[model samples]
Target: MIHPAQSLRTFIGSKNFEESTRFYQTLGFEVKKINPGFSLVKVSGNLCFYLQDYYQKDWCENCMLFLEVEQLDAYWEAVKILGLPEKFKGVKLSEIKKDDWGREFFLHDPAGNLWHFGEFFD
Candidate 1:
């Protein structure tokens, strides 16, 4: 029998390890530096990913992570108040957009990784 997986984490590459770590921290993620070249970022205990000191233009630009939230509007407002676009070069944020399935807002990290924060209608 196949056992259920305990947890899952993804590897996100960064163009600059230090700056990328700071970016995530600024975005309110808990970051623990593993070394000079890597760090583990956690949105929560079970929600985490690895940040590696690695990048490829094609891969980094194409990489996208979807984060599901309970309140899209509130999250968007908080994100706006953070002023990430003004603080970090190359960071970009978009207005919340509605889709047939759900609504989401876009955020682009300095390394060009795209993040989709959304919530589905009940």
Candidate 2:
């Protein structure tokens, strides 16, 4: 059976919608749709995700996203230089380290949505 959908996009909660959009943009995701209460962001070619203005402590705190990249070190350095954690306000970014998968790191958005960035080992 052929799948009809081309991709899956995750909807992430963002309390501070404006700043949250900026945060994703600063991290290299192209802001496609930005309105009063929602945003559609694209990372690279096919990866995309949504930002909802609605905020729920339970849902936001438990949300997670995993992104794979080719240049892990560069991405880590860029995020550090931009000081995303400080700029995003209450965001946290972990150092990139090697794991069973590959070099990766963790970070959270202002709304508490966790994100894991990694370069898988082939």
Candidate 3:
């Protein structure tokens, strides 16, 4: 039988593929280059996505994903190690906060894709 779903990765767009690749690299995602227009970025063992070169206004604007990390605080701190907030001017992020469901935070990549991070309470 085929395996059930385990994880997910979203393919989002980038106006400038090279710059976007660098942005994700700074976010601590390992990248495997396919071409000038495409790359596969592994966020973790089971999470990865294809970064494709595309710039249709509506499509890029509509792209978004919820990324589930094991630890929100550590993830944010490691990302901060890259100084990505300084690296990307006017970058956006949300503070870590917990609700009934889980603790979570958010950040926006250069391609304008919104990534929300969350995990269940211990």
List candidate 1 stretches off by more than 4 Å. Answer: none
- Backbone clash pairs for candidate 1 read none
Q: Please give, for residues 3-98, the per-residue lDDT of candidate 2 as tens digits.
A: 698889889898888888888888878987777788789887778888888899899999999888779998888888988877778899999889
Q: Order the numbered candidates by lDDT, best leading.
A: 1, 2, 3
Using TM-score, rank the candidates from best to worst.
1, 2, 3
Candidate 2 total steric clashes? 0
- Candidate 1 lDDT by residue in tens digits, 1-122: 98998779999899888888888998999998898788889998689999999989899999999999988999999989999999888899999999999999999998999999999988
- RMSD for each of the candidates: 0.9, 1.5, 2.3
lDDT of 3 by residue, 16-110 (tens): 77788888887778999888788889987878899999877688767778877787799877766677667875357878888998888878777
Q: Could you estimate the TM-score for every candidate? A: 0.96, 0.90, 0.83
Evaluate all candidate structures by whole-model CA lDDT and list the values in order: 0.92, 0.87, 0.80
Give, for candidate 2, the lowest lDDT window spanning 10 residues.
31-40
